[model samples]
Target: MSSRTTDGRSAATTAALLAGPIVMTAGMAATPWESENEITAYQAALAASPDQTQIAAVLLFFGYALMGLAFLSVLRRAGGAPRALRIPAATLAFCGATMLPGLVVVDFYDLALIQSLPAEQAAAVGERAGDYGLQPVMQVPAVAGLLLGGILVMLCAWRSGLVGGWAPALVAAGLVASFAVFSGVTMVAGASCSVVAYGGIALRLRSARIPSSPPAARPATA
Candidate 1:
C-alpha cells in the first residue's frame, strides 16, 4: 500500500512537471487568436466555410478542457490548501459553461453573414467583437466568470507564496474596480492577469522542482 501511494505521488509529480510547458504552449496559441485579423478571419471563415466552425470549435473546446484539467490537478496537489483549488475549479467550470452559449450564437452569426454579400462584410467587421445576437446576454456570464476566475487565481498565487504576489492580487482587484467604472478595463486587466498567472506558475514550477521546499535542518539540542 505504501509503495502504491508513493508511485501515485511520483506519477502526479511527473505529470505536474509537464503541465507548465503544455500551458505555456496554450498561451502561445491564445496570442494568435487575440489579433484582430485573426479573430475576424476565424469568424469569417466560419461564416464562409462550414468545416471551419467545426474545426475552430473543436480546437477551442479542447484547449479550454485541457486547461480545466490542469487547474484541477493544481488544486489536487495544493498540499492542504483545498480552498485555493475549489475556487479556481468552480470559476473555470463557470467559464466553460459561459463559452457553451457562444456555440449556438456563433452558428447564428455565420448564418447571418451568409445571407448577403454586404452583410458578410458587416459580419467580418463585427467579428472583432465576436458578438453574436446573444452576446449581450452572454457578456454577463462571461464577465462574471472571468472576474471570478481572476479572484481565484489570485488566491492561488497568494497561497503559493510566490514572488510578485501583489501582481495577481492587484490585477484581480483592478478588474473588480473596472466593473464599476464601466471602462472595459475589467476585460483587459482580467486577461492580462490570466496570462501572468498562467505563465508565472509555469515559470515558478519549472524553477522549483519540488513544489514545497525541504524542511530546515534542526539546530543541535543541548
Candidate 2:
C-alpha cells in the first residue's frame, strides 16, 4: 500500500483501539455495581434492569474486541524490535486479545441467566457453575491473557518508542494496580491509562509520515 494508505490504516486502527477504553469506561459508569464475585449483589443489580445489564455487557464485549485490534495495530507498528522479541510479543498479545471475547461472552451469559431466571434459581445455577469450576476456568485464562499480553505489548511499545515512555509505564502500573486491588477505582485508572496510550499513538499516526519501506521479513534458518 502507498504510504498515505498505510498511514490512514494506522489511524483507523488506533481509533478502534482507543474506542475500547472509552466504551469500557462508559460501561463501568453505567453499571455502578462492584465487579466483585458477589452473586447476590450481581443478581440484584441485574434484576434492577436486565436491559441495562445486557447493554453494558455488549459494550464491554465490543470494547475488548476493539482493544485486541488495537494491540494488533501496535504490533504491526513495532517493526523496530528484533524478530524474536516481536514474535513472542505478538503471539502473547494475540492470544490474550482472542480470549477477551470468550470472557465477555461467558459473563454476558451469566448476566442473562440472572436476568431471566428467578432469584433462587439463578443463585443456585450460578453457585453450581462456580462449584463446577466453570467461572474460574474461563476467567483465569482470560484475565491472564489480557494482563500478560498487555504487559508484553506495553514493553514492546516502550522499547520500540511507538508511544511515549510514560504512557506505557503508566498503563502497566495501572494494570498491576487493577489486578492487585480489583476495585472500580483501580479498574478505571487502568482503563484511563490505556486510553491515553492508545489515543496518543492514534494521534501520532494521524500526523506522522509512514515509513517508505515495510519492515524486513525474518528469514527462515535451517
Q: Report, for every candidate in turn, its global Cα lDDT versus the true structure.
A: 0.51, 0.73
Writing each residue's lDDT as its tens digit, candidate 2 over 5-91 gives: 886776677677687778876665555465565887777776776677777778877777676777788787888767777777777
Angstrom error at residue 194, model 1: 3.7
Q: Estimate the lDDT of model 1.
A: 0.51
| CA-only RMSD, every prediction | 7.5, 8.1
- Give per-residue CA lDDT, model 1, range 43-85, as digits (tens): 5544565554545445444444454544554454444445646
Q: Model 1, which residues run further than 4 Å from truth? A: 1-57, 77-112, 115-139, 166-196, 203-222
On the 0 to 100 scale, the lDDT of residue 217 in model 2 is 94
Q: Where does candidate 1 have its weakest 10-residue lDDT segment?
A: 27-36
Displacement of residue 115 (Cα, Å) in model 2 is 4.1
